[model samples]
Target: MQRNAFMLLMDEPRSTLDPIATAQVDELIDELRQNYLVAVVTHAMHQAARVSQKTAFLHLGNLVEYGETGTVFANPTDPRTESYITGRIG
Candidate 1:
Protein backbone atom coordinates (compact mmCIF):
# COMPACT_ATOMS: atom_id res chain seq x y z
CA MET A 1 0.00 0.00 0.00
CA GLN A 2 1.07 3.57 -0.62
CA ARG A 3 -0.08 6.88 0.75
CA ASN A 4 0.41 10.48 -0.16
CA ALA A 5 -0.07 13.78 1.60
CA PHE A 6 -2.05 16.57 -0.03
CA MET A 7 -1.32 19.15 2.60
CA LEU A 8 1.63 20.28 4.67
CA LEU A 9 1.30 22.17 7.93
CA MET A 10 4.35 23.82 9.41
CA ASP A 11 4.63 25.66 12.67
CA GLU A 12 7.55 28.03 12.77
CA PRO A 13 9.36 25.79 10.30
CA ARG A 14 12.38 28.06 10.24
CA SER A 15 12.35 29.20 13.83
CA THR A 16 15.36 27.15 14.93
CA LEU A 17 17.18 26.99 11.60
CA ASP A 18 20.19 29.13 10.88
CA PRO A 19 20.01 31.68 8.02
CA ILE A 20 21.33 29.33 5.32
CA ALA A 21 19.18 26.44 6.46
CA THR A 22 16.15 28.69 6.69
CA ALA A 23 16.62 29.76 3.08
CA GLN A 24 16.90 26.17 2.02
CA VAL A 25 13.71 25.26 3.88
CA ASP A 26 11.89 28.18 2.33
CA GLU A 27 12.97 27.00 -1.10
CA LEU A 28 11.72 23.51 -0.34
CA ILE A 29 8.38 24.97 0.73
CA ASP A 30 8.09 26.77 -2.61
CA GLU A 31 8.57 23.48 -4.41
CA LEU A 32 6.12 21.67 -2.14
CA ARG A 33 3.36 24.13 -2.96
CA GLN A 34 3.19 22.73 -6.47
CA ASN A 35 1.82 19.46 -5.09
CA TYR A 36 0.45 20.27 -1.62
CA LEU A 37 -1.63 22.74 0.28
CA VAL A 38 1.04 24.39 2.39
CA ALA A 39 -0.12 26.02 5.59
CA VAL A 40 2.55 27.82 7.52
CA VAL A 41 2.12 29.22 10.98
CA THR A 42 4.71 31.75 11.91
CA HIS A 43 5.20 34.93 13.91
CA ALA A 44 7.70 36.11 11.33
CA MET A 45 5.78 38.56 9.14
CA HIS A 46 8.43 38.72 6.47
CA GLN A 47 8.41 34.96 6.01
CA ALA A 48 4.63 34.94 5.66
CA ALA A 49 4.84 37.60 2.98
CA ARG A 50 7.49 35.68 1.15
CA VAL A 51 5.88 32.24 1.21
CA SER A 52 2.10 32.60 1.21
CA GLN A 53 -0.26 33.69 -1.52
CA LYS A 54 -3.09 34.32 0.92
CA THR A 55 -2.86 35.66 4.44
CA ALA A 56 -5.09 35.03 7.43
CA PHE A 57 -4.71 37.20 10.47
CA LEU A 58 -5.86 35.61 13.69
CA HIS A 59 -5.87 37.22 17.10
CA LEU A 60 -6.91 35.65 20.38
CA GLY A 61 -8.20 32.62 18.49
CA ASN A 62 -10.47 34.80 16.40
CA LEU A 63 -9.96 35.27 12.70
CA VAL A 64 -9.67 38.98 12.00
CA GLU A 65 -8.86 39.28 8.32
CA TYR A 66 -8.10 37.12 5.29
CA GLY A 67 -7.13 38.12 1.80
CA GLU A 68 -4.34 38.15 -0.72
CA THR A 69 -1.01 38.38 1.09
CA GLY A 70 -0.13 41.66 -0.58
CA THR A 71 -3.44 43.23 0.38
CA VAL A 72 -3.35 41.97 3.93
CA PHE A 73 0.13 43.34 4.35
CA ALA A 74 -0.41 46.54 2.41
CA ASN A 75 -4.01 47.42 3.29
CA PRO A 76 -5.60 45.35 5.98
CA THR A 77 -9.32 46.01 6.49
CA ASP A 78 -9.27 45.34 10.23
CA PRO A 79 -7.63 47.63 12.73
CA ARG A 80 -6.27 44.67 14.66
CA THR A 81 -4.66 43.34 11.52
CA GLU A 82 -3.19 46.74 10.80
CA SER A 83 -1.85 47.07 14.32
CA TYR A 84 -0.24 43.67 14.36
CA ILE A 85 1.31 43.94 10.91
CA THR A 86 2.65 47.39 11.57
CA GLY A 87 4.45 46.35 14.79
CA ARG A 88 2.02 48.38 16.87
CA ILE A 89 0.79 45.24 18.60
CA GLY A 90 1.67 41.58 18.79
Candidate 2:
Protein backbone atom coordinates (compact mmCIF):
# COMPACT_ATOMS: atom_id res chain seq x y z
CA MET A 1 0.00 0.00 0.00
CA GLN A 2 1.17 3.60 -0.66
CA ARG A 3 0.14 6.94 0.70
CA ASN A 4 -0.72 9.45 -1.99
CA ALA A 5 -1.51 12.72 -0.20
CA PHE A 6 1.27 15.22 -0.76
CA MET A 7 2.34 18.83 -0.79
CA LEU A 8 5.04 20.19 -3.07
CA LEU A 9 7.12 23.09 -1.85
CA MET A 10 9.25 24.60 -4.58
CA ASP A 11 11.60 27.40 -3.67
CA GLU A 12 12.88 29.15 -6.76
CA PRO A 13 12.62 25.92 -8.74
CA ARG A 14 13.34 27.77 -11.98
CA SER A 15 16.05 30.03 -10.65
CA THR A 16 18.91 28.20 -12.40
CA LEU A 17 17.15 26.48 -15.27
CA ASP A 18 17.36 27.60 -18.89
CA PRO A 19 14.23 28.59 -20.80
CA ILE A 20 13.60 25.06 -22.06
CA ALA A 21 14.16 23.54 -18.65
CA THR A 22 12.06 26.27 -17.08
CA ALA A 23 9.12 25.43 -19.32
CA GLN A 24 9.44 21.75 -18.48
CA VAL A 25 9.48 22.52 -14.78
CA ASP A 26 6.53 24.86 -15.18
CA GLU A 27 4.53 22.14 -16.90
CA LEU A 28 5.43 19.67 -14.16
CA ILE A 29 4.32 22.14 -11.52
CA ASP A 30 1.02 22.70 -13.22
CA GLU A 31 0.41 18.99 -13.58
CA LEU A 32 1.28 18.30 -9.95
CA ARG A 33 -1.17 20.93 -8.78
CA GLN A 34 -4.01 18.66 -9.87
CA ASN A 35 -3.25 16.13 -7.12
CA TYR A 36 -1.21 18.02 -4.56
CA LEU A 37 -0.98 21.37 -2.83
CA VAL A 38 1.80 23.36 -4.51
CA ALA A 39 3.50 26.16 -2.67
CA VAL A 40 6.04 28.17 -4.64
CA VAL A 41 8.32 30.96 -3.56
CA THR A 42 9.46 33.02 -6.48
CA HIS A 43 10.44 36.54 -7.34
CA ALA A 44 8.89 36.19 -10.82
CA MET A 45 5.61 38.05 -10.65
CA HIS A 46 4.37 36.53 -13.89
CA GLN A 47 4.99 33.02 -12.65
CA ALA A 48 3.33 33.78 -9.32
CA ALA A 49 0.29 35.24 -11.01
CA ARG A 50 0.09 32.36 -13.42
CA VAL A 51 0.55 29.37 -11.09
CA SER A 52 -0.91 30.43 -7.77
CA GLN A 53 -4.58 30.76 -6.84
CA LYS A 54 -3.65 32.90 -3.83
CA THR A 55 -0.79 35.33 -3.33
CA ALA A 56 1.05 36.85 -0.40
CA PHE A 57 2.90 40.10 -0.54
CA LEU A 58 5.71 40.38 1.97
CA HIS A 59 7.90 43.37 2.68
CA LEU A 60 10.95 43.45 4.94
CA GLY A 61 10.13 39.96 6.20
CA ASN A 62 6.63 41.05 7.15
CA LEU A 63 3.41 39.83 5.57
CA VAL A 64 1.90 43.00 4.16
CA GLU A 65 -1.06 41.32 2.52
CA TYR A 66 -2.41 37.95 1.39
CA GLY A 67 -5.42 37.20 -0.79
CA GLU A 68 -6.58 36.06 -4.21
CA THR A 69 -3.79 36.48 -6.74
CA GLY A 70 -5.79 38.51 -9.26
CA THR A 71 -7.26 40.76 -6.60
CA VAL A 72 -3.93 41.32 -4.91
CA PHE A 73 -2.14 42.07 -8.16
CA ALA A 74 -4.87 44.17 -9.70
CA ASN A 75 -5.84 46.17 -6.61
CA PRO A 76 -3.41 45.80 -3.74
CA THR A 77 -4.71 47.34 -0.52
CA ASP A 78 -1.30 48.18 0.89
CA PRO A 79 0.76 50.99 -0.59
CA ARG A 80 3.99 49.00 -0.15
CA THR A 81 2.59 46.04 -2.03
CA GLU A 82 1.49 48.33 -4.85
CA SER A 83 4.83 50.07 -4.96
CA TYR A 84 6.76 46.80 -5.31
CA ILE A 85 4.41 45.29 -7.86
CA THR A 86 4.38 48.35 -10.14
CA GLY A 87 8.18 48.88 -10.10
CA ARG A 88 7.81 52.09 -8.12
CA ILE A 89 9.74 50.95 -5.06
CA GLY A 90 12.72 49.31 -6.72
Candidate 3:
Protein backbone atom coordinates (compact mmCIF):
# COMPACT_ATOMS: atom_id res chain seq x y z
CA MET A 1 0.00 0.00 0.00
CA GLN A 2 1.15 3.60 -0.59
CA ARG A 3 0.77 4.21 3.12
CA ASN A 4 3.50 1.74 3.99
CA ALA A 5 6.01 3.01 1.44
CA PHE A 6 8.85 5.26 2.59
CA MET A 7 10.49 6.29 -0.65
CA LEU A 8 9.67 6.40 -4.34
CA LEU A 9 12.29 5.99 -7.06
CA MET A 10 11.21 6.83 -10.57
CA ASP A 11 13.37 6.40 -13.63
CA GLU A 12 12.40 8.77 -16.42
CA PRO A 13 8.78 8.43 -15.28
CA ARG A 14 7.77 11.36 -17.44
CA SER A 15 9.46 10.35 -20.67
CA THR A 16 6.30 8.93 -22.23
CA LEU A 17 3.93 11.43 -20.67
CA ASP A 18 2.48 14.43 -22.43
CA PRO A 19 3.34 17.89 -21.12
CA ILE A 20 0.11 18.23 -19.13
CA ALA A 21 0.45 14.81 -17.58
CA THR A 22 4.10 15.42 -16.81
CA ALA A 23 3.17 18.50 -14.77
CA GLN A 24 0.55 16.53 -12.89
CA VAL A 25 3.11 13.87 -12.07
CA ASP A 26 5.52 16.55 -10.86
CA GLU A 27 2.84 17.88 -8.56
CA LEU A 28 2.16 14.41 -7.25
CA ILE A 29 5.84 13.89 -6.61
CA ASP A 30 5.99 17.10 -4.62
CA GLU A 31 3.09 15.91 -2.50
CA LEU A 32 4.72 12.55 -1.98
CA ARG A 33 7.95 14.26 -0.89
CA GLN A 34 6.11 15.59 2.11
CA ASN A 35 6.37 12.05 3.50
CA TYR A 36 9.32 10.38 1.80
CA LEU A 37 12.73 10.70 0.25
CA VAL A 38 11.96 10.71 -3.47
CA ALA A 39 14.82 9.66 -5.72
CA VAL A 40 14.15 10.41 -9.36
CA VAL A 41 16.71 9.41 -11.94
CA THR A 42 16.05 11.37 -15.08
CA HIS A 43 17.94 12.56 -18.11
CA ALA A 44 15.73 15.62 -18.24
CA MET A 45 17.37 18.57 -16.55
CA HIS A 46 14.11 20.42 -16.17
CA GLN A 47 12.39 17.43 -14.62
CA ALA A 48 15.16 17.09 -12.04
CA ALA A 49 14.90 20.80 -11.34
CA ARG A 50 11.20 20.47 -10.73
CA VAL A 51 11.10 17.58 -8.25
CA SER A 52 14.38 17.38 -6.39
CA GLN A 53 16.34 19.47 -3.94
CA LYS A 54 19.54 17.51 -4.47
CA THR A 55 20.81 15.95 -7.67
CA ALA A 56 23.55 13.45 -8.42
CA PHE A 57 24.94 13.66 -11.93
CA LEU A 58 26.39 10.36 -13.00
CA HIS A 59 28.55 9.97 -16.10
CA LEU A 60 29.98 6.75 -17.43
CA GLY A 61 29.88 4.91 -14.11
CA ASN A 62 31.31 7.89 -12.28
CA LEU A 63 29.67 10.11 -9.67
CA VAL A 64 30.36 13.57 -10.98
CA GLU A 65 28.74 15.89 -8.52
CA TYR A 66 26.63 15.64 -5.35
CA GLY A 67 25.18 18.75 -3.78
CA GLU A 68 22.25 21.12 -3.59
CA THR A 69 20.35 21.46 -6.83
CA GLY A 70 20.94 25.18 -7.10
CA THR A 71 24.63 24.87 -6.41
CA VAL A 72 25.04 22.08 -8.89
CA PHE A 73 23.08 23.82 -11.56
CA ALA A 74 24.38 27.33 -11.07
CA ASN A 75 28.00 26.53 -10.49
CA PRO A 76 29.03 22.96 -11.20
CA THR A 77 32.65 22.27 -10.26
CA ASP A 78 33.21 19.43 -12.69
CA PRO A 79 34.05 20.27 -16.30
CA ARG A 80 31.76 17.43 -17.31
CA THR A 81 28.94 19.02 -15.40
CA GLU A 82 29.58 22.34 -17.08
CA SER A 83 29.59 20.83 -20.53
CA TYR A 84 26.44 18.85 -19.87
CA ILE A 85 24.52 21.74 -18.39
CA THR A 86 25.54 24.38 -20.86
CA GLY A 87 25.41 22.16 -23.93
CA ARG A 88 28.45 23.86 -25.33
CA ILE A 89 30.89 20.98 -25.66
CA GLY A 90 28.92 17.91 -24.65
Each model's backbone clash number: 0, 0, 0
Q: Global lDDT of each model?
A: 0.91, 0.86, 0.87
lDDT of 2 by residue, 16-68 (tens): 78878878888988998998889899887777887789999877889999999
Top candidate, metric TM-score = 1
Worst 10 residues of 3 by lDDT: 81-90
Clashes by residue pair, model 2: none
Write candidate 1's Cα lDDT for 40-75 as tens digits. 999989889998999999999999999999999999
Model 2's lDDT to the true fold?
A: 0.86
Return the TM-score for candidate 2, rounded to 2 decimals: 0.83
Clashes of 3: 0
